[model samples]
Target chain A: MFNEKIVNPNELRHWEGRIELYWIYTSGEAGDRFFKALKDEEKFIAAKCKKCGKVYFPPRMYCEFDFSETEYVEVSGEGSVRAFTVARLDKDEKPLEKPEIYAIIDMDGTDGCMVHLLGEVEPEDVYIGMKVKPVLKERGEREGKITDILYFKPS
Target chain B: MSVGKKDISCPPEAPGTPLKDSDIKEKKVTYVEDHPDMRYAWTAGQAISRFLNELKEGKLIATKCNKCRRILFPPRIFCELCYKPIDDWVYVQDTGTVQTFSISYIDPDARPLKEPIIVAVIAVDGASKNMAFMHVLGEVEPEDVYIGMRVKAVWKPEEEREGSVTDIKYWKPMEK
Candidate 1:
C-alpha cells in the first residue's frame, strides 16, 4: 500500500480478459438418445424388457433380477406429469445459473417414468398427477436433444 | 509347478528410469485379528474342489453324495438337501459351455484398457444350471460368442505354469 504497486508493473493491461469456453459431453445412452430424438428427429426412446414385460424409464441393458438383456423400445412422446420438483442445483450439486422445474412424467399408458423439465407453471401450482404433453421443439430450431422441447407444459 | 512355494531363487532386475504414467492400483488387503479365522477346506467336499484343483495338474474331478447318490461337479462339499458335509471327489472334463458374456471395452476400474477383452461366464459340463466361472474368452469375434457355444481351456506353456487360473491363459472355441 505504501509503494502504490510500483506503477502496476508498467503495463497497460493488468488482468486477463474473458474468453469463450466449450466442452463435449458424452452421455452414455439414455441421455444421448433423448436429445437425439428430441432435437434431430423429435422422438423419445425407452427400453422394454421382453422377459419381464416391464419397461424402464432411464433405460438399462440387463435385468437386475435374473441378469437378462433388455429390449429397446421407441416411446410416443405423449405423457402426463406424475411428479415434479424444482431443481436449483446442477448434477455436481452446484448452484445453477437458472432454476428449472424437473418433473417425472409417467408416460401415457406405459409402466415407466421420464424425468424432464417443466415450463409455464408457478411453484405452488405443480400438482402430483397433472395432465401434460410433450411440447416438441420446432423442427427448424431442433438439434435432436432434450432441449428441443424447451420444457413440458400443459397439452 | 508348486503352489505358493517360496524356495526358488531369483535374479536381480536391471534398474530403469521413471515411467511416463505412474498410476497406482488400489487392492484392499484386510485382516481380522480379533475374530476367529473363517476356514474353508475342500477336504470335506473332496469329490468337487479336489478335482477342480487337480485340473491345473491336468486332471478332472467330481463327487457323488453317498446318501442321495448324485454325481456333483465342481465338487459339492456338502449334501445341499440334508445339510450333511460331503467327503468325496471325482474327475470331470475341462470341456464346458459358454453361458453369457460381455465384450468389455472398459477395464475393471472403468478405464480404457490396452485392448477390448471378452469376459465370459462359462458353465462347466458337470456344473448345475447358472453355475459358471468368469474367464477371458478368445479365438473368435465378440459377436460369435453365444449362450450355448462350447469352449475349452488353452493352457500356457508348461515351464510358465504357476498353478493359478491365469495358467489357463484364455478359453477358446472347442473343436467341433
Candidate 2:
C-alpha cells in the first residue's frame, strides 16, 4: 500500500518554447503553369478535363473525380463573390489595425473557387454574387506568387 | 466502360511543363514562401515539478522505485518498467559524469554562433547507472571535454534562481 501527500498548488511548474522555423513551398506542375502565366503574362489559367468538361481554378494536373489528365485553358479571371468574412485578428490573435475582408470567389469558367482578400469595397457593401476582377501587382514588382494578383476589386 | 485505372483516360492537350532545378534558379517557375510563428507552454508534471523546485534550491533529486531498485534522474512519479508509483524522493549530488558530448558550431536555427558551444548528456551521480540528462558543459576548453569526465553543477546566484533546468548555469570540470 502507498500513501500520497497533496502538493501545494503554487509549486506547479511549466516551461516555455517556441516553434521557430520557416518553410519554403513549391508550386507543383499545374500550379507552376497557373502562377507563371499570372506572373509573366498577367493571365489566368485553369485546368479542364476533356472527358467530363469540368474546369478547375487553381488548377491541378489530374481531375479529382475521374483521375484523368487535364488541359490548360486561359480564363478572364473575373469572378463572383460566393462567400466572405471580415477578419479582425491576426495569426497570433493580435487585433489588427484595420479589419480585412476575405472572400471566396467563384471563377467564371471553373468549377472551383479561390479564397482571397477583397479590396476597394466596404465590408457592408460586399454581397454574394457580386462581380469582381483581380487587381494585379505592378509588372516590375510582380513575384511569381498568388499575391501577384493583389486582390479582387468590383469590376 | 470500365471502372478504376483501366477506364481512366487523359485529355488530348499536353500536360504542364516540368521545370528542372535550373528553371527554378532562372526564375522560370514561380513559388511562394511563408514563416509561421508558433509558441507553446509545457507543464513539468508531478515528479519533475518537484525535481525542478529542488534544482532551484541548488540541489539534485531523483525518484526511486523500491521494486526495481532503479533511481531515475529528471524524476518521474511512476516507474515505466515496473508500472508502479515511485517509492521515495532521493537527494542526489550535483556532480555527474559526461556520457557523451558534441561541439556545436551552430545554434538551434542552424546559424553559426560567435563562439562554439559544448553540450553533453551527463549521467548524474546517485542515480541508477546510465540515466542522463542533456546540459551545456562550460568552464573548460572543447578539447578537454571527454567521455567519462567528472563534472559539477555551477548554479545561478540565489537571487537569480528560477525553477528551470537553466537554474544550473552549466556544469564545469570537477577538480582532481
Residue B109 miss distance in model 2 (angstroms): 24
Which lDDT tens digits does candidate 2 get at residues A26-130?
A: 788888888888888999999998678899998988888777778999999999999999999998999999889999999998998999999999889999999
Give the Cα lDDT of each candidate.
0.64, 0.88
* Candidate 1 residue lDDT tens string, A14-115: 223344443333444445555555566666666676666677655665445444566767777668877778888988999977677899889874677778
Candidate that scores best on TM-score: 2
Tell how far residue A6 is off in model 1, in angstroms: 81
Model 2 lDDT vs. the true structure?
Answer: 0.88
Name the TM-score of chain A in model 1: 0.62
Which pairs clash (backbone N, Cα, C closer than 3 Å) in model 2? none
lDDT of 2 at B129: 89
lDDT score at residue B86, model 2, on the 0-100 scale:
86
In candidate 1, what are the lDDT values of residues B16-133, reduced to their tens digit? 3232212111211111122334432222222333443465686546655667666565555566865675545555567788888888889889999677899888877775565567
